[model samples]
Target: MRIGTMLGDVLRSLFSRTATRQYPVERAQPPTQLRGKLYYDPEQCTGCSLCVEDCPAYAIELITIDKTKKQFALRYHVDRCTFCGQCVESCRFKCIQLASNEWELASLDKAAFTNLYQRAENDASNVEKVAATDVETPDKE
Candidate 1:
């Protein structure tokens, strides 16, 4: 509160380093296992809905085409995701994964965060159907 003490404090403030960073010039590297954007490899997925079933936040939804192949039509709506990595961990096939990509999430509408992923071939479902049938055996009494 004294005038002389205030003047001394003001002098020290001018020489101190800034708390803010120079951002663009000094980019920050994300840590290992940093949860950023979610990425799905269509070829790796089986449309089993295991990731959807394990998601704690219910952020994942599985949409499939009802052909003989039972192909996955879409995998969308990740905006409500909490980045808990539960879906990633639950994927037995290593189909679900998160990309290191970050910083494009901002948008005026909430819909902007929703990402869409679609599968090309339907071989996964066919494999499932074959596996299901292979487990059965005729009973001989």
Candidate 2:
């Protein structure tokens, strides 16, 4: 009986394909609904910061612009990200999205794991510093 089982195993090994993927050499595509990385579209973003507040992982930060836009000028962080999709669900503007970047996440440096989320303006222009006009002025002497 043992000899027959060993023969069957040998034949199975010869005919069956390998189960593991080659990783970097051959990566599997993530499913359409799989939440991999979160991306933010600045133009579509309302700067409501709802995504920030809704983040259970506290991975998101919102830096606001002082102008009338009332929207976040720069927003990004990946330090403690749990990859939870709560933030995306909270966004009413549909600015947040789950990106397909599944395999490139590993990094020797801890900071590399962080997914930087930025708005469209942040990509084209530097973050503008708030001017003194926005600050409360002291009473006249």
Candidate 3:
């Protein structure tokens, strides 16, 4: 009886549709309201740290350049982000948005997920300053 049942199941399986997604060839469609990656527009940012404060995962790292001027550089750690949309909701300046369409962020290395988002106006000068500070350590050689 067991052999008969096994044989019947195997025959049914041969005609059944595949139950797995073809990820590489065909992408899965995320829900319309899915909160995916966080999009930060630096020009709209007030550097109020509301998003930083509200994030449950502690994913947002904000470097305040000038509190009076509201200049901020946001370092988004995607690996630690929970996609809870709390940061987006708490942002009063409307600078942070969760791009629901940007969900294909898979990577092998954790470092690749650390994305730097800032306005075009502040990027150049901040990049230079960060680079200068990074290279300041003396070589052991």
Candidate 4:
């Protein structure tokens, strides 16, 4: 490495533009077919465990809330998810899908990433009981 060549290289490097993008100022757009966060639509879903069975990372779990009504609660853990889109593909009702144009999924706590969609049977009953009690409260004269 000659001194003259080293000096020339250093000068060229100093004048070159930065390759990194200013993420906060100008966020990069995700590709059209990018696999982002997993979204579960309980209204559209029929409690079929196909999505759970197909998930390679075991990130999805379906809990039956109402046995008579066939109501289910979907538990999705983003930390365990690989964004492979297998669960999305396996869903027959099209209730499972990767959210579009959403790539930023950072979280300080792992517990924040676990998304529980749909109310449990016990939860619904508890809420209703609380409301009933509130409504039936006697007035203090």
Candidate 5:
């Protein structure tokens, strides 16, 4: 390459506008159809394990707290999820969905990857105990 041509190219690049967006500070709106983090509503859920069964990555678990009251808890493994929207598709009661705005799920804590969702009126202590025991973290060894 000639020095004049190289200098011209460098000058052109320096004068041109930046191609990349400032990701964290200036965010772009996610599309409506974009599949993101999985959300579960226990109130609408019928305690059916269809979402659990439909998940190819086995990321969702539906646990029954009380059969009579239809109380349930959803254990979601975010790290294991593939964002395939299978759980959302399988749910007949419209209890599960993939939030378009919740795509940024990166976390340093392993416990953050495991989410336990239960009704507010349900026993918090019981749910906490269950979460404590059920949450599986990798050995740091």
Candidate 6:
């Protein structure tokens, strides 16, 4: 509490190097096993809802496009996701994974939180309709 001691401490702090790094400007490499954004490959998926069942946050939804053709689409709610990697672990076909380099998922738009992954050959109009209709919107304030 002495004036001299306080003055000395202030001077030392002023001359010392910053303890934190500049984040956005000087980005560091992400870790190899970092759980970032969720990804899905429908080609290998067998329409199994194991990922949906295992998700603690209810972030993933598997929609069956064609049962005979094994065509499917995955609706991922990023905002609801906890990035826990439970979906990745539950998927037996290895169709799901968390991209390590894609950690920057921030967005101002509410629509951006919902992602639909489907094959190029599938009917875009139908899938869009399904996605739009099924996507749950947060309750108004």
Compute the lDDT of residue 40 as modeled in candidate 3: 90
In candidate 3, what are the lDDT values of residues 36-119, reduced to their tens digit? 888898887876677877777878777666558766677788988999988888988888888889887889988779877766
lDDT value, residue 106 of candidate 6:
96
Candidate 2 wrongly placed segments (more than 4 Å): 1-4, 114-141
Candidate 1 residue 62 Cα shift, in angstroms, is 0.9
Poorest lDDT segment (10 consecutive residues) of candidate 4? 131-140
Candidate 1: residue 72 Cα off by (Å): 1.7
TM-score of each: 0.67, 0.71, 0.78, 0.75, 0.85, 0.84
User: Which one wins by TM-score: 1 or 6?
Assistant: 6
Cα-based lDDT at residue 136, candidate 1: 20
Given candidate 2, what's the lDDT at residue 26? 93
- Number of the predicted model whose TM-score against the real structure is largest: 5
Model 5 TM-score, 2 decimals? 0.85
lDDT of each: 0.64, 0.62, 0.76, 0.74, 0.81, 0.86
Residue 8 of model 5, lDDT score: 100
Would you list the rank order by lDDT, best first?
A: 6, 5, 3, 4, 1, 2
Clashing pairs in 1: none
- Which model, 5 or 6, shows the larger TM-score? 5
User: After superposition on all CA atoms, what RMSD does each candidate show versus the true structure?
Assistant: 9.5, 7.5, 6.6, 11.1, 4.9, 4.4
Candidate 1 lands at a TM-score of: 0.67
- Write the residue-wise lDDT of candidate 4 on 60-139 in tens digits: 77766554775666778898889999988888899888986876899898777987766433475543444344322212
State the displacement of the C-alpha of residue 82, model 6, in Å, after optimal TM-score superposition: 0.5
The number of residue pairs in model 3 that clash at the backbone is: 0
lDDT of 5 by residue, 64-89 (tens): 77768877888898999999988888
Please identify which of the two predictions, 4 or 5, would achieve the higher TM-score against the true structure: 5
